[model samples]
Target: MSGASIRAPYDNPMDRHLATTSASPTLVTGAAGFIGFHVVRKLLQRGAAVVGVDNLNAYYDPALKEARLALLRGADGFSFHQIDLSQRDATARLFAETRPETVIHLAAQAGVRYSLTHPESYVDSNLVGFGNVLEGCRHNGTQHLVYASSSSVYGANTHMPFSVHHNVDHPVSLYAATKKANELMAHCYSHLYGLATTGLRFFTVYGPWGRPDMALFKFTRAILAGEPIDVYNNGNMRRDFTYVDDVAEGVVRTAALTASANPAWGGDAPDPATSAAPYRLYNIGNTEPVDLMTMIGVLERALGREAQKRYLPIQPGDVPATWADVDALVQDTGYRPATPLEDGIAAFVAWYRDYYRA
Candidate 1:
């Protein structure tokens, strides 16, 4: 979809069938975010008119977000707006002005641990902000809405590979709860207003420009600085660490393939991932779960330094493991993420070194 080769792994030539082509601009929220930045870059490379919006909050380092924004500023057919979706007036005004054809909504208050400390942030950003986005899409005649959900929605379900078809009523953390709420809210819009919506349940996403709070970034920083790294769950956690590039590709593909009502869907035996209305849910993950220790080892090799790890019990509101069943996504989009831990870690370490001038 861009000058940069999209390396989404699948042997289906029909992938181009879902590719989107429109005169109206594509709206990307959280344009300064890690995944959002990559998505915008890819869309810009494809010569799509894009309007980006972000409050540029201090959730993490604003400078990192600023750096991402700066890269997008150089691209043609790209525009940026500093607006908060939580604010109803501003969000409404933005939609009225731009009136985007397709929307990729990624902005939210992320992190399970942070949600414990700041629960209100989740409600405001995830719930309230998402409601605003849905309204904006509905009122503006937006064709398709691709919003971010999380693998954490699986919560207490000990299922090996989390499936969108599985029930997700028992969310462990507030962050997870809010993401689940986003899906429900999108379904409401899709049902009542005839809006097309797709919810992406992202796995543990990481790569170049990953959030500093994530394990990869923290571990790399501590190891390089000769500091001790916190290894939670006594190094017994597992995650389907999907690379950012692959995740971005999935987002783009999903956005292109607008949600459509499932003719086979019936209330007698409901499928959680799809509905009679134009609403769908798909997990975007690597599908392979790697142990925490294995990830650390990969990082050590990438940085050429062993971490001084302090093993600890699993914290509250944290899961022991998370793996995704992406059969639905592959069936729908003909794409699956295949970035190995070794290669992804190497790329991240290289980027971290260069960006920080380490």
Candidate 2:
């Protein structure tokens, strides 16, 4: 802790520290997707060399993701490669070529409903693909590896404001199971290979350029198209609707720092989210739970039309509510979601109208 060198888990770390503006090349998987696109753009704005990878699969509208990529292509020192995480050979080659010192793993088979229909995609992208990424980091001397986990890991828990210290052993869906598996796998790598890993358990993130599968995006489209927007759980559910910008800020802050084992970490009275190795888990969410009906009302006001709503019971693999307790994230990285749901919804509606020319 004496020298000007940044705190690294290992003595001979491979991280490119800023001795005199020593910025390392960073890799972002799923760079064309909602959260990934925002994180990459923010990194570029901060004068970081960024390499983006996305399979550009037709799971959603590839054209929309392509447009996001198009906007990102003009930046200097920013590169994009169309590759699937499941393709071990191709992913390994890219990692070898980039020689990235830090990686953000965001490319996973997303959506609760989609996982039920196509479970293989979740296994392909979240489990196998994640293992390949770990293998690359282990050999390439990666200093810091940050990956996305989900709040859905708190399945069947009636706990308000889910904390990383709590146990998350039970998962409802294939998607949540894989996300939980990611944390376990990352812990294993950190324990064995000394990889500084941080897993971010994100809540219901929403904002501009959001995913079409999310409730905000789908409700906006349906409301504008003069169709009924489905209100799940009979509009009684609650969610910590975090803004995407806030999420990006948290991700950037977390990436700049490496996880370390707490010196006083206990084994018998263990925290499920941290380890004796250089590994940590954090919950990134708004902390403020907004009711489902309240969110729809905000959308209605933004669109200037009452949504024809069809209320239904909670679907399979859907959680009733989610609230993130971000105390540890704030302590470690000064990270917390700040956007209010009303303002965020309005901003999203504005972006949706302009982006789609509605």
Candidate 3:
């Protein structure tokens, strides 16, 4: 592995927070997935040995996952494993063999609409898979486990700029419910097993090589193909669309800073974001919510194609607006997501055009 720090394009103030070298490899689940792939690259660039695990399921395109994996395979200090985390025995063996000191758990069934039809996938991947990961970390002497939570957990929450301290008991979708469950499960482990766990509730993350099912990717494809793109809630939605690199930076920085007991935490007040145990939760986002139609306009400019809009009512389990309050993340990491919407969209469109040869 090269001992050089992460270079430009991916470089940020958080680079200083990364350890020069780790005694044990950092294991990142869903390494083939979009966010996991970026996080792994960032870690490997910082000279950290990374054991990347992904089942490469056909939920979307396994080809894209494989492509992401191929890039990581070429990098030094990075290794890939094909393992379905829902399988208890396989996950246990992986933990025993790798014994990673820091585990970044990013694998889970991701999608809101799909969850309505295929609720079983959410159960197997998000709930069962997450349980296996927690078990692995608890038994393997893992120092810290920084896992992905989603802004979707703010379901039915009308409060603008969602804060981690707010209660999230009313999840509108199974996917969101499962993510909330992961936080609760992590808290249980931290309270009982002395595990240091941090949960990051990421807003709508988008950039180059993002997931196919996400709005940005789908809209880009539809517009380029001259198909009418579905405009849900009649383009009335608002999202804190964070850049992928920014999210990755937050993940790595938070991983380096292990969770600790909040001395001020009390049973009387009982803060939801922190605890007496070594558990913490933060909202990692751009902090700026963009209108759906405005984002579409930006993308139109980037791709030089106008999308034919098909207006539709909001789908079940979909929130009309999402805004993330990232004050806690900034206070902890001394970094905030500052990518401009135009720049991020341009980057994604460039990658999309190049990758598709369009």
Please report the candidate that would top TM-score against the real structure: 3
- Pick the winner on lDDT between candidates 1 and 2: 1
Error of 3 at 207 (Å): 0.5
Clashing pairs in 2: none
Across 1-358, the per-residue lDDT of candidate 1 in tens digits comes to 2233433333334333333356778999999999999998777655567899999999999999999888778466788999999999999999999988899999999999999999999999999999999999989979999999999999999977899999999999999999999999999999998999999999999999999999999999889999999999999999999999999989988888889999999999999999999999999999899999999999988888988989899999999999999999999988999999889999999999999998
- Comparing 2 with 3 on lDDT, the higher-scoring candidate is 3
Candidate achieving the largest lDDT: 3
lDDT of each: 0.90, 0.87, 0.92
Between candidates 1 and 3, the one scoring higher on TM-score is 3
lDDT comparison, 1 vs 3, better candidate: 3
> For residues 1-358, could you state the per-residue lDDT of candidate 3 as single tens digits?
2334333333555554444545788999999999999999888776677899999999999999988887777576778899999999999999999998899999999999999999999999999999999999999889899999999999989988899999999999999999999999999999999999999999999999899999999999999999999999989999999999999989999998889999999999999999999999999999999999999999999988889999999999999999999999999989899999999999999999999998
What residue pairs clash in candidate 3, if any at all?
A: none
**What ranges in model 2 sit over 4 Å off?**
1-23
Please give each candidate's TM-score.
Answer: 0.95, 0.94, 0.96
In angstroms, the error of model 2 at 182 is: 0.5
lDDT of 2 by residue, 1-358 (tens): 1112212232112122311134558899999999999998777656567889999999889888988898788676688899988988998898888877889988999988889999999999999999999998988878889999999999878877799998988899889999999999999999999999999999999999899889999999999999999998899899999999999878878887778997777898988878789999999999999899999998899899999989899999999899999999999876668898889999999999999999
Cα-based lDDT at residue 299, candidate 3? 96
Give me the runs in candidate 1 sitting further than 4 Å from their true place: 1-20
